[model samples]
Target: MTAHLPVLQVVIPLMAAAVCAALRPARVAWAFAVLVSWTVFVIAVLLLREVLAGGTISYEIGGWAAPWGIEYRIDVVNAFVLLIVSTVGAVVLPYAGDSVEREIRRDQIPLFYTAFLLCLTGLLGITITGDVFNVFVFLEISSLSTYTLVAMGRERGALTAAFRYLVMGSVGATFIVIGIGLLYSVTGTLNMVDLGLRLSELTATRTVPVAFAFLTVGISLKLALFPLHLWLPNAYAYAPSAATAFIAATATKVAVYMLLRFFFTVFGATFSFDTMQLGFVLLPLALVAIFSMSLVAIFQVNVKRMLAYSSLAQIGYITLGISIGTVTGLTAGILHLFNHAMMKAALFMALGCVIYRVGSIRIEAFHGLGKRMPLTMAAFVVAGLSLVGVPLTVGFISKWYLILAVLEQGWWPVAALVLFTSLMALVYIWRVVEAAYFHPSPTDEVAAAVREAPLSLLIPTWILVVVNVYFGVDATLTVEVAGRAAEALLGVPR
Candidate 1:
């Protein structure tokens, strides 16, 4: 059973998704999803522990051997990622009950959880699989489920947003599958490890470089990297609050993991950074995303869209760290990956609370909310401060490492820009804060009627809020794990 933990991580949620779809009562399905998510998270924790103590764990399907039989591989890098995905899924599932009940049609609630579980299964599958082709399969599964989830938004525009995402997502999938096909054509192996080993012998081939380009762009689309991130704001803004929180936290992070796996592990860091000079492309994009998106976020009236744009900027921080192309840089990227998950999830969930009580997320909707929904608004403020990278918050931890990483590279100019964007984050966050705390609550009935969000919603929001601070103040554990994961990816000795 212990040996099968890698497979079980993906399997349990997948099987339960079918059962969830068949369940008659939406509340029952929610309860079942909560159970399945917690179980998957426990499996993820056990897998991470096993990898930390014993190193990488690999399991073959039906007793078949690797390169022939499909394999699920868990190492420090992906093990940590699996933990991120499952942890967010577990935390967000419990929150989904109240948020979903309010946002989605009552009859559609069961299907929402069903899609959520399938999305979870796909994300875990993408992270755990060792076969390159299997990544594409799981990517599609998650993508399809995500489109359905996005369309479940209460607004009519959700259908348009979902359709746009579907078209863009399909194009990204096509590029990824084409890249996978190109690699298979040259290497005659779909297993990632075998492909890596074989590709080392064929570096002079034109096919590999083309495949790399295809995969990079494809993944950039999926991860919502700057210029390619146009679909994300609308999708996130219009999606059901539960769906927005879950997908915003986990989906892009998983896509970043895929980019790392392909670039560092499959192609090798030297080939990716030295031969191709991938950092040249990534650095410029990262900088633009940070500065441009941060500016865009400050102007947003719709709070959800504001945070969605902020997510693009946060992705910039992650990619910026990766662009430095050093062990410290990679660690910073991985740390931000984890840290941003907590920050953004908590922020979105707070907005979920706002939307639940007020039925609106416009900045004006938050006027005097600090007094009306004190706990929920307070949670938002703390999480907002984290997003601004204040001292003693997870966001600050991520930036501290990023600053160190850039300084280590003697890229002082880049380091300064990072600081500048931190201010940008502050401005955008302050917009909401000022509205909530400083302005007067509208005299309208809805504004007057708004009260503190229910405990059911507040509990989940605060759980992530506490996590944002807990991990920030005592980051020794996350730093150690992220450092180890980065070293492992770069083949640096412990």
Candidate 2:
């Protein structure tokens, strides 16, 4: 059973998703989805424990050895990612029951749960697989389901957003496939570990750089880093709030993980950093993404859209850490991956509760929410404070590491820019706060009628907010895990 945990993490969700699609009753589908997600979460926790205590676990699918057959490799890096993805699904599934019932059509509920489970499966498969081609397969699985899930939004624009994402996402996936094909032609193996070994032998080849270019562009699109992020705001804005919260929390984080896996694991530091000089290219782009997107987020009228752009800016922080390419820098990047997941998930879930009550997520809709829905507004405030990098919030821990990483490279100017961006975050967060608390309600009826969100949504949403503060105050687990994961990626002793 222990040896089979790798396959179980993904298989349970994949199989359960099919069952959900076939389930006649929507309630049953929800129950199955929640069960599957909880099981995956447990498997992920066990996998992490094994990796931390015993080191990497390499499970050859069907008992075939790696390089010849598909492999599911569990290591500290992917184990942490697995935990993040599965944990989000576990939380979101229960929350989905209430949120989906309100926003999605009753007849469509089963399909929504099916798509959600499929997305969960794909993310876990991408994290667990050791085969390069399998990554593309799992990526498409997630991307396809994500499009369906996004389009299920009651908003008419949801279809358009899903279409746009499908087009852009398809192009990104194609580039990744082309890059993988090029690597396969050069190295003659689809297994990432074997490819890594062979790739070192072709350091001087032109195809190597071409493959790198294709991969970097492809992953940047998937992760929605800066200029390539046009598909993100609308997708988040139009999707059902539950879909927005789950995808916002996990999707791009998984893409960022893929980038780290390929850049550090497959290509190696020497080729990626020294030969290709990725830092020169990525550092500038990341900086642009941080400042430019934050500026754009401040001007948005829709609160959900504003938070979507803020999500893009946060991705810039993760990318910037990778661009630095040192152990401390990588640690910062990886840690932010986890921290931002908690903060953004909590924020979006809070917005979902607002949408449930007011049937909208516009800044105008939140005119007097603080007085009516104090607990919900408080959750938003806590998450917003974390976004602004307030002390004792997960956001502060991420920024602290980012600043330390920047200083490690003697780039005081860049460090200052990071601080400046935090102030920008504060400005945008303040906008929401002012609207929620200070502004008068649009009407007396709205002020009189508004109440707190149902307990189902509030519980999951606040659990994440509580986690944001809890983890912020106690960073031992996150720091230790991320630090070791960073060392492993850098080929240094933990």
Candidate 3:
């Protein structure tokens, strides 16, 4: 049963999605979706525990041996990602019921849940699968469902955003597939571990670099990294609040994991760094993303769009850690991957609650929110502080390590730049805080009617808020696990 955890995590959601589409009643479909999401979350937790306790678990599909049969490989890196993706699904699905009902038509709710389940399954499958081709299949599964989910938004521009994302996402997927084909042509194996072993032998070949270029560009686009992030703000802004929260938290994080896996595990560190010099190329881009996006975030009139830009800046910090390419740096990068997920999810969910009651996420709409919806506004404040890297918050832990990583390289200027970006984060966050607490309500009627969001939304949002602080205060679990995961990727002996 334990050995089958990987398959169950993905299969449960995939099967539930099909069943959801067939189910007539929206309530029944939602219940089934919730059950499947929770099941996957449990499986992910179990998988993580097993990996931490006993190291990697490689399960061959259909009981066939690897190098021929497909593999579901579980290690610290992907197990952690599995936990992140599934946990987001588990938390968001419950809140989604209320939020989606308000935003999407009654008749569309069932289909919305179906697409949500399929997207969840795809993300989990992408993290768990060790077969290269399986990643592309799952990627498409998630992308298609995401398009449908985004298109279901009540806003008129949602269809346009969804269509634009569909076009960009499809092109990115094609690049990834072509890269995989190039790799397979040279190595003749689709299993990640096997490819890792064979890729080093062909490092001098021109095809290796070509494949790497394709993969880097493709994954960067998917992850919404800096210059390639044009599609993200519109996507997050126009989508339904629930869809925005879910995708903001999970989708790009999974793509980052895939990028880390391919660069560190499949390509191997020596080929990626020493021979190809990927670190030099990525480092500058990450820095530019950190500063430029934060500036853009400060100017956005819509709160959701502001957070979307902030999300891109946060991705920069994660990428910066990866570009450092050392054990400490990689640990920082991986830990940020988890921390950012929690913080962003909490922040977006808080905005979702605001949108639920106020029917808008504009910055001005937040005026006097503290007096009207104190609890919901308080949740937003806490998450905002976390985003600013306040002490005893998960965001601070990530930034601390990122700075330490730069210092380790004796790059004082780079370290200072990181601090500068944090100050920019502080400025934008303060803008929202001032609007929520200090400014008077635009209209007294809105102030009179506003109350805390329903418990359904508040609970999940606060759970993530509490986690942001809890993990910050006690960094042992994240630090240790990420350290081990980093060491493994760096080829250090256990």
Candidate 4:
């Protein structure tokens, strides 16, 4: 049982998701999802501990030998990713009951939970598996389920958002499959570890470069890396609040993990950065995304769409860290990955609470909300502060490290630009803050009817809120894990 924990981490959720569809009441299905998600989070915690105390844990499916049979590998880097995904699932599912009930039809709710579970399973599978093709397989599983979840939104536009995402996602999947097939044609094995070993000797091969190019574009599409991020804002704005919270916090982060895995673990940094000078390519894109997306966010009237755009800009921060391509830089990239998850999950759920009462997430709906829904608005403000890199918040910690990384590289202008963009974040956040606190409600009925969200929603949301502040002040855990994760990917000795 202990030896098989790696496989159990993924299998339990997959099996539970299948059963969730048949559950009688939607609440029961949600409860089942909550249970399985928390259990997986516990498993992730344990896996991270084991990897830290010992070393990488590898499990061959059905006890077959590696390089010939399927393998699930766990190491510092992916263990950290697994922990982030499962923890977000656990936090988001408990909040789903109220949010989903408000946003989805009663009849469709059970299937919604099933789809959430499937998405969770796919994300976990993508993080834990060692095969390149397995990554694509799980990527499709998560992508297909995500489309279903998005389409379940109450708004008619949800269907359109789902359709657009489906088209873009299919294109991404095709490119990834072609890339994987090309790699196999050259190296004759599908295991990522085996491919990495074989491809080192073939670094200059034309086939390797083409495969790398395809994989970069495919994975970039999945990560919503700038210009490719058109599908994200709508999927987030119109989807059921629970789906937005989960997808916003986890999906792109996992795609970024796929990029890290391929660039560092599979291709080797030398070929990726030194020979190809991928930094020159990625750095400009990251800078443009950071500025352009944030600029777009400030003009949005819908708060959810504003944050959706904000998410794209935040992704640029993560990519910029990666483009720097140093130990401190990678550590900062990975750190922001986890920190942004905490911030967005908290902020979106706060918005969900607002939606629960006001039935909308538009700027107009937020009028006088600070007086009506004190706790939810407060949570939003704190998380919003963190998003703007204010002191003693998770956002600041990420920025602090990110700035240090930039300065370490002697790119003073880049560091200044990072600060400038954060102030832009403040402007957008302040728009909602001012509307909620200073403006009067248009109708007396809204003020009378709106109240704090139910305790079920508030409690789970504040758990993340507490984590944001706690991790910010005492960042021992995230820093330690992110450092080791970076070391592992960079092949540095612990």
| Rank ordering of all candidates by lDDT, starting from the highest | 1, 4, 2, 3
lDDT of 2 by residue, 289-344 (tens): 99999999999999999999999999999999999999999999999999999999
Clashing pairs in 1: none
Give all candidate RMSDs, comma-separated: 0.7, 0.9, 1.0, 0.8
Off by over 4 Å in 4: none
Query: Backbone collision count in every prediction?
Result: 0, 0, 0, 0
- Answer with 2 or 3, whichever has the higher lDDT: 2
Collision pairs in model 4: none
lDDT per residue (tens digit) for residues 1-494 in model 4: 78889999999999999999999788899999999999999999999999989999999988888888889999999999999999999999999998899899999999999999999999999999999999998999999999999999899999999999999999998999999999999999988899899999884678888999999999999999988998999999989988999999999999999999999988998889998788998999999999999999999999999999999999999999999999999999999999999999999999999989999888988999999899999999999999999988889999999999999999999999999999999999999999999998767765688888999999989999999999989998899899898888888885
Cα RMSD, model 2: 0.9
Compare candidates 3 and 4 on lDDT and give the better one.
4
TM-score for each model: 0.99, 0.99, 0.98, 0.99
Looking at candidate 1, what is the lDDT of residue 270? 87
Candidate 3 local lDDT, 1-494, one digit each (tens): 87788889888889889889988678888888888888889999999999999989999889989989999999999999999998888899988878888899998889999999999999998999999899999999999999998898888888999999999999999999999999999999999999999997764789989999999899998999879998899899888888888999999999999999999889999988998899998899999999999999999999999999999999999999999999989999999989999999999999999988988989888888888888898888888888889999999999899989989999999899989988998999889889998998877676668788999889988998999999999989998888888998898887
